[model samples]
Target: MTTGRPPRSPSPSSSPDPFQVKRSSVARLPPSTIATSYPSSGHEASVYAGNRSITPTSTPSLSVSSSTSSDDTVLDESDDHDLHTALTSEQISSTIRNEFGYCANQNYRCVSQHNPEKPVAEDEIEEPPYYILFTTYLSYLLVIVFGHLRDLIGKRFAKSSFTHLMPYDGYAPLNSDFDSFYTRRLKQRIDDCFSQPIASVAGRTILVYDRYSEDFNRTQIYTGTTTRALNVASYNYLGFAQSHGGCADAVEESIKRYGVSTCGTRLEGGTCDLHRIAEALVARFVGTEDALISSMGFATNSTVIPALVSKGCLIISDEHNHASIRTGARQSGAHVRMFKHNDMRSLEVLLREVISQGQPKTHRSWRKILVIVEGLYSMEGTMVNLPKIIELKRKYKFYLFVDEAHSIGALGPHGRGVTDYFNISPSSIDVLMGTFTKSFGAAGGYIAGAKPLIDSLRMRGYCGPYAEGGAPCVLTQIIASMASIMGVSSDLVLPTSTSTPISESSVNEVLMPSVADERPLPSKVPASALPAWLSLPPLLSDGSEAYERIRRLAFNSRYLHAGLKKLGFIIYGHPFSPIVPLLIFNPGKMPMFARMMRKLKPTPVAVVVVAYPATPLVTSRVRFCLSASHTKEDIDVVLRACDELGDLMDLKHGRGERWPIEEIVTRSVELVHSI
Candidate 1:
């Protein structure tokens, strides 16, 4: 060999280069959009979608034809998960084996670009990732096993339910013809510990641990022999809702001000000054000229969707739209349509069809073709392509309404939200909606957009608490204080005008355009506290560390993700998200696993189990959360538990064999084909 020569390149040895990626698919995608016609630099795409090759268009391209009535047959054994669409092809498009599961760039070179000759074994390429393989394979396992799994789970619960039918050893059924024993008897029966142990609080050990001390060095109020164990079985998508405490203070203040109730529907007695202030904060947060507040994120979506739509409107919704949107669309009274989730091309096809069909429902109702979307889909924790959606909106002349209930505070820089996350103008989104419970940690919601839209709602359909007596005094203080606390200028209230249209263009230049600044608007006065919508209490954000940590949550989430992934377990959420779901497929194992996690450490954690009613039966998962209070060590403990449980499940399921890549790969591919 030449002295110091770039060590003579290894021959094409017997060991196949893991770095050599082979795209076995019959087709290839262009490096850029198909419409752009930019040639790729020989980088193969493991990323697959049925011809997502082109950029998004205004017309709907995906034909919403049924695959087959037989394939769509409801499994008789499958219980009512309610979320029947969880298993849709639209939701489970990518696999870990498929490209995005491991690396951020699905098209990055596997080996050192400089040394093409020295490649690692193809099997050694950790690029595709193990989790993706696991999930893809698991999904396949679900397809083959969901019905059986559903029956097994149902049978377990069913057998457990019939404790009443069982013959009690002592005093069981009371056939004594005395009706007097009803109330007393009922109380005794209700108190009877007849039920089977649903799950063990301690998987293998009854641990005496303190979660607060272990995780945060703070007080964990729930622990020990007499711990208040609440079944948070419905807690879905990890615990992003409870991770932040700023929401608790905001909720308290809101109650003090708004008086714990909208009192009625927003259109009835519910709309209050409290409601308006809530909407205004949201409007500022989302960068819109107008906004509305509602009881829930679901309502924000359902209400706005139909109000903006009419009989002739055509909607090109992501096939995987959250249930609320689906209900809204179905009830919209407009011509409803759908596209593949995140499929720009499918949306184009639908949009084109609607446009070609042409002529709005008698233009008397301002051509109302509205594009609706959810910020962070609750289950998958996936994101919509906002940039593409905006483009389609502009091109198709459709109004865009984005529900940011899940996107606020958890995504994007400074949590300006999904619009901000995409680096797109918040102005492009015709409507923005969010819930207070997630990022804000409050218990309400708001919608934002142009003043005319709200004005129209107010005149024809508007009704709020103002219709009753007045907004509660406490809500005003909370709004003022919250606005102050959130660092919002006091004059959040826009001038009320029922007679004339609010001039937005003139308003933006003269008044504070975005709600982000600390300076007061021309009309706004300094309030005692910031608005509760900001959710930061006076005592809380005042601390330098509190503010710093609040700002760095996303970084913490990323760190936690890296840690957990290294331990070999699944974590759910979009890229760069604080939310994580430590997924476990077995519904039965959930409660048991939670107890295991709690007992495994010095402090037992009750990781919530998201089951049937929250997610589909096929989507049951254990949601593990990360808190700002968590230190690096805390995350590692959680990660270890996740790994242990995952390993346990894989080992116990079949011949104690590990979940092999070859098996997962072939299974996942087969599942994809069958779908």
Candidate 2:
């Protein structure tokens, strides 16, 4: 199975050879020498790092399916998985919103233990710019070290493998190595991409989304300001963040029982029955025999990573894997190698290297191997090629850990995720990790697989040792039961079942909006409705609570997608689901684009700005998430705005309201009142 660079996008392959790629994107990826060259003159830096992307030939194509008169019908259950996944991501992304940001702002007033050296705003004194930069840099560095420390500590413990960076830090100008440079570069690249806003003393904002929103509604999140000229972005898939019943319910429950702080680790007071139950239910839902719950999906990866690989072990990872996996792999004292995204050939090359090292007994020290991948690549909105990778796992004898954070309820014939989507036996995978936060519309992550494997990881994984509490328990149990229902209900839970990707006909039959098929449509169900299948009535009733509302949302999403696309926006996620990412070029254009969107519609969407660190510069886009709350009329307002913009941009049709607004104002007499 040749899975290296993504397959050429339908027609011609634009993928240059590896050497060429190395010269362009991957090469500049600071080698161990960045310590010698920390960009001191941030002021003199390139106004733009320049958005760039190196899409593999094997990456999935963004093929659009247009509707004709005859195609109106219920989309098949198979495509329902993505709608669920899309909605889930949308829900999470949306949660990063204003109220959350407001809460974060409020929390800032509290005293801080870590940074006791506080800078009071006496006489409105802003710290010197250089000092601020230094503080910010130190903060970034701390995050990098803390985030990747597991790798550093692992190497030291192994003696034969790991290299300690702390000791090297004091060496010369700095302990410059591939590891150091890599970690630094990761932070630098991300920070540089989202250059801190130029506001003099803007409020530090952190959107505090109602954590429970992941179930059925998306929470809209805003990181900076409503006024921050729009170049920044978020993951809002369904826009459920602003308001959603499931999200509200979950947040209410979490605050009520957990009361904000565990004060200690899960093993300490943190390990409530709530965390334990969630862990078990999540494990089963994701098709794993067992699971370990974590504070976050990322923490799950961070902890499980180094715990699994050791001394003579090796880790084969995808080039495009999330930073969490990379961090974990680094901590694992094993030799780490990377394959191109979805590229089986690159993985094979690394596998061969490991196996070819020596004879069996002699090579026993480095015998173990773990292959890790995200169920769905965040930027590409594509899935891991499971079948191709699984073959390698079977042949080479390597443990597989899939980060199904993005795809748990998004893919597979049954919404069982990538593994189930590909029809691989559940036990074939050594470990499975997912988040109840996403698909279930709540917050918390889990790791499931063989019970022994999970148990061992919990007791030994890096964070496991430090964790006091596991995950939220009550939520996970409910999630598990929902997953159980998904297995049986093709119309809502997972897809019916598929050996390959869902067929186009199935998609049209289930997702398309048409009166021809009054039956339940796949596209219209509130992704939150997936787990709510148990709660659904046997007969689909008109205007009922769960099912009735879900259908409306599905219809709204499609209507919104159609309206937005009509205005020349490249829609992502899908109308069937709720995520709609708008395609754009220059990062500079994003803010203006978002503002334009807001002004144009009666109830305009706050477009999320996306650029480099989060996605390739070339892939700069604005995500426009829709929801069940939206009305067909609301979609019309958006479309009319698009029509106006289309005309401004010289598009074929000018999108605008056919009617005009009437306004009245008086200026003469009121002008002098204040004076």
Cα-lDDT of candidate 2 = 0.43
* Cα lDDT tens digits for candidate 2, 1-675: 221223223234432211112211111111111011122222110111112121234432110000001111111112122233434432322322221111111111111011224321111111223443354456547645764674566656754333343454455423544556543434333332232233211111122111122322223223433232111133222222322233333334444444565531133433554444444345445544446767666788877777776656667788878888888877767778787767667788887876666323564434456788887666544456666677787677667888887666544334456665455556666677876543344456777765556546766775666865533333433443233323223443323455244322232122212212222213223222222212222221111222222333344445554455444444444223344555554433444565576443224333455655676534456654443333343344545555565455432222332222111012211211211
Error of 2 at 560 (Å): 7.7
Model 1 Cα shift for residue 31 (angstroms): 55
lDDT of 1 by residue, 571-653 (tens): 55543455566555554455457656545534344455565546644455665444333333334445445566767765122
The candidate scoring highest on TM-score is: 1
TM-score of each: 0.54, 0.50
Backbone clashes in each candidate structure, one number apiece?
39, 73
lDDT of candidate 2 at residue 616, scale 0 to 100:
57
